[model samples]
Target chain A: MTIAPDRLSPFQDEFYSALMQAHEGLTEAQSHALNARLVLMMANRIGDLDSLVDILKTARSYEHG
Target chain B: MAYDYTPFPYVSPPGLTAPEARHRVVIVGAGPIGLAMAIDLAQRGVASVVLDDNNVVSVGSRAICWAKRTLEIFDRLGVGERMLAKGVTWKIGRQFHGAEEVYSFDLLPEEGHKYPAFINLQQYYAEEYLVDRARDFPELIDLRFKNKVVAHEDRGNHVALTVETPEGTYSLQTEYLLACDGAGSATRERMGLDFTGQTFQEQFLIADIEMDESPFGPDPVPERWFWFDPPFHAGKSALLHAQPDNIYRIDLQLDVDADGKAEAAPEKVIPRIKAIVGDKPFRLDWVSVYKFRCIKLDRFVHNRVIFVGDSAHVVSPFGARGGNGGIQDIDNLGWKLVAVLAGEADERLIETYHDERSHGSAENILNSSRATNFMTPKTPIEALFRAEVLRLAHDQPFARKLLNSGRLSVPCSLEGFPLQTPGTGAVPSGRAVVDAPINGPEGDGWLLEQVQTGGFTLVGFGDVQLPEVDGIARVGINQRSADYPCFTALKGLAIRRYGEGRAYLFRPDGHVCASFTAPEADAILAARARAMGAELEPSR
Candidate 1:
């Protein structure tokens, strides 16, 4: 499965901008901390163990050795 | 238009000349709470003497938000309609993060309620209207302006008060000394009571500005607008509310170490106002800089001398809970005190006021405190969490609930209280009765108006005949002609809200004490007895 056209609907660009804006003036460590919290919150929003596992495996495919 | 601050006449009391007879009740402070307390008692055929140091209504627009539950209680006290007409009605609240809107909510989406979700009116207008309403019962409510309670001693059976008036000092006695005195209560101080809770370090500059144009801009409907890190005031919270007489209330969060005097000065305030309104012609009506505290007495009912309103508890203004919570305290205490005085119930019934309203005040404090903490984060981690929450709130539905702009006042439920008999229905036991439109033989009316009488009431919905009980009024909805007052539920909203074929028993304060699917005469009596504190007796 690939990213759907409606992945975040019309808010795709807006959401991405907001995500970047969240780390506007934070240090690298603080940015990483924010990313960690964001991932946890998004995972909580997704709220499905099997689907989260599938998504985790799918995201791992993008990582190159 | 500015409100005229007319001072009420200061008439010296009879006690000034000679020792007056022991009164039934004495309420300190003639603010909204004390005046409303006196009016509520008077309506219940219990007379009270209201004393106050000041002769005027609240100076500024202190508590601008009057919630629906408070309005219903005010309606019973005779000033609800007057306020509803004079105040700006609003239900929608919008929360913003910086320049972007995060979340919005409709407080009362559905209709059929007599009053709206919330109304914004100057506290002075409400107090003035209450004073006018309090005058309707001149024989019952003795309003003595400039009467300061210098000292009070609880004398087992009664309270002895030393009041200083413009004429001279005088001695008075009362069966119950109700300390409706506000946050800085002299009465509470005299009693040496401990008021414990959290006080925030952050100070807010609240100003009421008048302008011909709406700050909400072009074709604005009055709504509560809250912003965090708003563009005008970066990295701080601000609130805008519309009140009567073209007055708009704006609260701006100030730095923890901001000079209170400087922030409240017109020089400093004008630029802040201009920053938000942008060259819009506006006049500053009132401005004050102050921090908020969430505090309450360990016990509201302290023997013969009981506390009500701010004297009992105080909360931050975040949730509009401070004033609304005080009004709820009056609603809970007034009926119980009247019952105890009239011998309809044991004195222990008054103790339940402490049990119920203390719980209510605690709930308000908890909510308002949490919102204040979220807005004014003490730690960097807390700020991070809040910022992330606001960011997610703009998109994720689940994240919206995490936003703490102010919960807004709703009637707290007393479901598990001892006075309430557990049952199943649309309105749960021990919750405030929901208002619904109805038409009776005489004319159209609301369900709350009929049920909120000064005595216990039984509302029979569709074929559930009201049981005949002494001292309890009966009303039927959508029931065929019998004996008691019957009404057709307009649009069947009453029947829908209150389950069909169910009998709801309400206390004098309009809270559902019990509900029955199959109501029995003996069962109804037992429940009434239980509500009146007979349940506290070992014989029961």
Candidate 2:
């Protein structure tokens, strides 16, 4: 699911751009490794995965619907 | 008596004549954690009194790195912007073996948080900011400095404390006491809690020095610079951190015995710096020798006295996580205390604090140990392993993981918390949807943006209305454009992917409470009521 640049709010664009820049030079494997760690770290920070899953499913449905 | 014939120059306020009845909650320390608890309590309309022995905030540097999550908390308190303005943001960090740069990682990319990359401001400045904020709530909070808790007796209903003030001794009665009183917590000791952990074998020297020549390469960035190799103190590592005012805080591992007890001298540190940077003139600002230890109280709370910050847990400062972790402990406990005090939740919520925060502390200690293991290789075999890992990190993904895992500044969630339900079905990890750019209905940033509020926030993505509980606040976002105005300026990214009719409830302290599809209002309210510990029926 690719987020469209035009649809992104100002802060969104800045964050997306920065994130891309952070991963710019890394290979796919490196990026994936970093992403996996980030996923766990973020999960820990947010603390509730069941709720987050509900959020993700809702977002995905919104896109597909 | 004869001289008293003249009227007094000034009459004190009526309330001043007698010490106001002791507050319900008395925080024994006015350090950052103590002040933070006071602020949180005051915000919840809970009366609190904070007492500190020191008259002035500490002058020398202590903790340097403020994690992204902490910055978010500061933002809620309206001080994060000022901190971000004064502090340096570091996103990229490099690992060194001797003078060689081995592995580098970018911390900014994967952290969907809307705050800056990690910020570096001296611990004193952070405390000063918190103290200044506390001054605004004079009525709700009483901040007494130079007053020490000489004695405390936990009476069944209230804790009676005898404090020494400049004038004389006075007695205070408070329902609960919080010890934010550093590692040498008298309250913790008084409660007879056992602190369990191991202390490092060697001692470390920390110095704040003004370098005449920059040790950083051209296009210098503020990062954790590590030097791992011999001669500069064999089997020891040096860390250079750029602080404000052109001062750099340097940490050097020293070859000293467990009983080594020497004050950090510039002569010893300068010669070591000369070994690495080749004889550059520098001025020493402050220096201290510290022995690293990893210890945590068996329990965080005893009777009515609770421990926060260093009193509860102490970890090595290798990852710069100790003080930051300490602040987070209070942040997690603050709201729970409010809930318990306000009768919004049961005392059971307080027990989860130790369970969750101890887990976090354990993780932080683990990460710090990893960094220490790599930076200060104790054994020759370990040294060889570190060297080989660094060499492979140049091209290998696993090497990057080993190196990046050492930084360990990410916030841990409480999904697996014993008190939390595992959920009826598969839980969404929030990773796949993280990159999507969906905004809140009111144009607030996104799911990540809401996490910064520093408490439980329930985000209703659709037009669904949630039954209100006393302590919980519900925000409904229905705007098609993901530009919620409330969170437009915050530091986290917007969620770009989600189903239209979904809603999520977040726990106070920035954890997800629960999520649901379009459900009957009754079920949602019941779940919330149970989670928040509200009586099934309203009180008459």
DockQ comparisons of all candidates to the true complex:
0.07, 0.02
Task: Choose the strongest candidate by DockQ.
Answer: 1
Off by over 4 Å in 1: A1-50, A53-65, B537-540
Instruction: For candidate 1, give the lDDT of residue B302.
Output: 85
TM-score, candidate 1, first chain: 0.82
lDDT of 2 at A16: 31
Cand. 2 Cα-lDDT: 0.65
Chain B superposition TM-score per model: 0.99, 0.85
Candidate 2 stretches with Cα past 4 Å from truth are A1-65, B1-20, B110-112, B211-213, B230-235, B258-263, B277-281, B379-384, B387-397, B403-405, B418-456, B462-472, B477-493, B497-501, B533-540
Model 2, B269-322: lDDT tens per residue? 677666656666677777778877878887786667888889998888877678
Real interface contacts reproduced by model 1, as a fraction: 0.00
lDDT of each structure? 0.89, 0.65
